[model samples]
Target chain A: MTSEFELIRNHFVRPTPQAILGPGDDCALIAPALGMQLAITTDMLIAGTHFLPDTDPCQLGWKTLAVNLSDLAAMGARPRWALLAGSLPEVSEPWIAAFTDGLFACASYYGVDIIGGDTTRGPLAFCLTAIGEVPIGMALRRDQALLDDDLWVSGQPGLAALGLAHLQGRTVLAEPLLKPCLAALQRPLARVELGLELRRRGLAHAAIDVSDGLLADLGHILQGSAVAAELFVAQLPPLPTTADPVLARQCQLAGGDDYELVFSAAPEKRAEITALADHLALPLWRCGLVVGAAPGQLTLLDDQGRVVPINEKGYDHFG
Target chain B: MTSEFELIRNHFVRPTPQAILGPGDDCALIAPALGMQLAITTDMLIAGTHFLPDTDPCQLGWKTLAVNLSDLAAMGARPRWALLAGSLPEVSEPWIAAFTDGLFACASYYGVDIIGGDTTRGPLAFCLTAIGEVPIGMALRRDQALLDDDLWVSGQPGLAALGLAHLQGRTVLAEPLLKPCLAALQRPLARVELGLELRRRGLAHAAIDVSDGLLADLGHILQGSAVAAELFVAQLPPLPTTADPVLARQCQLAGGDDYELVFSAAPEKRAEITALADHLALPLWRCGLVVGAAPGQLTLLDDQGRVVPINEKGYDHFG
Candidate 1:
């Protein structure tokens, strides 16, 4: 049997040139760059709750780190370091190797160093804490949205949920949509560049990742900013012609698992943001606008400007 | 049914004056003090592995954070913030309230801020990431042991193991020893001040927390420093009179769960360390010396000036 130390050395240990001290020590030491603040976030993924027990180790690893990186991206922080603490029912060298491969692949892409973590025996679960750096007092905050700001979302927000629905046999996706949907579900990319550019160029006033569907996550920004929103259903990214419009609407409105960014910016910056979309070759959909109304209140509008009642409010881990 | 947000607002939310942004945001933002290096560590506690399933919620919460704090203590860092990512079998309000109570108590005592984390529904488990600050280049590293340094350990090393033995019916403890042993096992305090003073004053050449047994943890320092050790068994803290001497010896030699600090210091600093012990009113046991030998080699010496045969090295989580 491989000892814990052997397991760490073989699988988890990697060259962390960015760290003052990496794994094997009681703690990993790092120095945040001068005049920078650290943005820290943690996410716990439990087998069966976050993914199927037999989910592919590689994709699981990618998604796990991606979700936390998305959090940093939402804050306009450059990804820096991560610590992954996990529990496994038993040790399987091949599983661990594949998992580390995927995890390191993501870390490498984001220029993040896996500094330190702990692993123990138990039900399969992983908790990752990611740390990123942003210039002092310059992180895009959720509470800074100005009234009448143009609210935008990146990428298609409902595809991952559609992929999940297909997986659960609730929706049948067309062949062309299957791969992209599943990719969105299993390997969503963190919007690090988009977020950094938005912050550095002063394009966004407030931002949040669209993890819990567009409406629900947008609700966070509205609530935090003590404002309201007017979302035009017609302006949301179009549902695929082959897909069920109602289900896609539901997914677009309240789907979970989308790692897209939903941000609010001054209306005048819309042209600049559109140019940014072309520059990054990514879609930037303007689907809503911040409004002055009761805090936490949201109104969905149809193309004709009629109120559309909403029932689904996004994913709740407990609900 | 209570939503995850309600649970977070009701139980996990706490004032974080130190954080630029706290819970409810995608990430917590903190600025490490200028001219300071950040020491970060992560620990995962799994049910039935790290603690019994029926363990008291309050104590489990305290021990979970304490163990990670112990790691910070080992690095001679001043713990400043923590992120707790946990999975729960279900949402039980009372249990969460009690757990947070204990968690906050420890954080308050140590001057740490509970910044942010994630919680989800799943099997019961927790992962905590602790971040601390140390003066640049002044952290007590495990690789800095100099030849001929006197090795020291703080407080009792074997009581926690004996406490486990008592709980497991492997041994019976006398009335007087029961409370302290159990306390050592369940509520072991992190020696933050001792570690801080040792590093700030440059009194210790190397340090590591005695979590995976004194010998095993000490071996980390030995291996990292490319040095060896000669531990005087007779000079170790005395075994309890009422306990079986042989069993006590085994526990003292290779006990796990002891959150004590074992350090190595130059022979010249012995007087200052002794004075520190007196000042802190904590027993600092001098038990060994660093030796010039093949790296990672360790020798156990009996009072009769003979080498003692050894079998148990320390606890292996995977073994």
Candidate 2:
């Protein structure tokens, strides 16, 4: 078991910048630029529930921060500061250090400060509350998508699901998908740049991070916007290599922990968006279109013009 | 065990006026008032580590918030919004509901919105990341106190320590300490009014909220300012009722969790400080005077000019 002091001294405690107070006291403090509203979100990754028991400590740490960044990305807010509370199964000094390295790599990648938090002995559970900054009223919401808008998702999908399959021994991942797949699971990138670009262009109708699979995540936009969506099976960004394309698409729609952005925008802005995509050099694949508010329906169209039966409903915390 | 949904919907799901995108979404969308710098802070409370197993749910919830409010208080910032993450031992409906009620009372008292967070199945743990608004460069810091300033503390000390002692069956509370003692533990109030008063009058040099025993917490102020203090034992506010005055002062020196403000002010501002204290209707007791560059030293003096031996330290998570 890792002693709480060793973990604190090694991983979580760091000298903060002049403007901020680091963890030690009852609270960590920060001063945000004036008049800007804060964007805040929290996520909990339990050892057995969110990750496998054998998941590497470094990857686990990275995912914890990455998932929080995905939430900030969804709101078109740049990462700023994060508070972490970790409940450990036992004390492991090396594990804490490795985890801290991975977590800080992502934090430094996005320029977020590690502010305040706590560590305690318990089941291996980690929770992060990320705070970000955006100009007041500029945050994107799921309900803002308009009908008939074209939907875009950054980067490819199903790689994380394939990674999980490989981890679980459900399938043998070939060399091509192996690196991409594992990276997808181990180090899912948050779409911070894409979100900011869309917000800067003032073009996106609505946006959400694809944390719980594309279909389920998009279901949030549909439910909130009071609209349905038409997802084209063939239009998804290409995966590495598919042993079965249908299963792969299903994974894209149902697999979890892919932190790509699924968002909607006006059809008229299509060319502008494409130009912006070229500028950013990240994928902006248009995978679907918004539909009228018929309520409680999401339909998928195949190349053969048949509606396929979907089996996976994505992951649920309790269900 | 409490299901995740039930735990979240009951304890955390506060209906926020600024929650354009509420829970169940990828990120929360909020609108902060324009022209105010956001003051952010994070505080964590761990089960067993911070609270006893049989602690009342309502008190746990209230103090969880009061502690964070104390941070905002220390910064001389106005509390506006909060993010909460709770890890639960199991789903207890009544416990959850009572906890929510207690938490909301604090939020309502301070006019803060509950924005976002995560709930997980683990040992009881909570992290609250709070945001406030203050004029840039106007917030207080530990290094701002001048060496020759007057040292002050609000409210009586050692009550919460007595309350906890009673709860743990280590001591018996008697008379006035019983009511204030229990209240100190159950509904620790943040000195929000005192904070505002200090800023309004421009009388306070530096300030901190007391959680760790005064000796240890004041040590922080001394370390940061590189100054020292000679604390007069007789000047400490009466402990309500004490069988032995010497022991009571000893408790005052090491007592913790009296969520009051300890501040420094120029000696010339004493009368104005008294006026502000009367205006707020909270007692303001000048307990000592800051000593110049006796650097890194804190001493206690009795009426007979004897130095009291101080040994007990504040509560520590690892210890």
For B33-94, candidate 2 gives per-residue lDDT tens digits of 55445566666676776677777888788888888888888768788788778777677778
Evaluate candidate 2 and give its CAPRI docking class based on DockQ.
acceptable
Model 1 in CAPRI terms: which quality?
high
Lowest summed lDDT window (length 10), candidate 1 chain B: B1-10
Model 2: residues with Cα > 4 Å off, grouped in runs: A1-36, A52-57, A85-93, A117-125, A168-174, A238-250, B1-7, B18-25, B29-35, B174-176, B240-251
Residue ranges of candidate 1 with Cα displaced over 4 Å: A1-5, B1-5
Error of model 2, residue B88, in angstroms: 2.8
Native-to-model Cα distance after best TM-score fit, residue A27 in candidate 1, in Å: 0.6
The whole-model lDDT of each prediction reads 0.90, 0.77
Model 2: lDDT equals 0.77
Candidate 1 on B105-211: residue-level lDDT in tens? 88988998899988888998989999999999999999999999999999988999998899999999987988988898888899999999999889998999998
What interface RMSD does each of the candidate structures achieve? 1.3, 3.2
DockQ of model 1, rounded to 2 decimals: 0.81
Tens-digit lDDT track of model 2 for A145-190: 8889998988887889888887888878788768888999998898
TM-score of each: 0.98, 0.90
RMSD of each: 1.4, 3.6
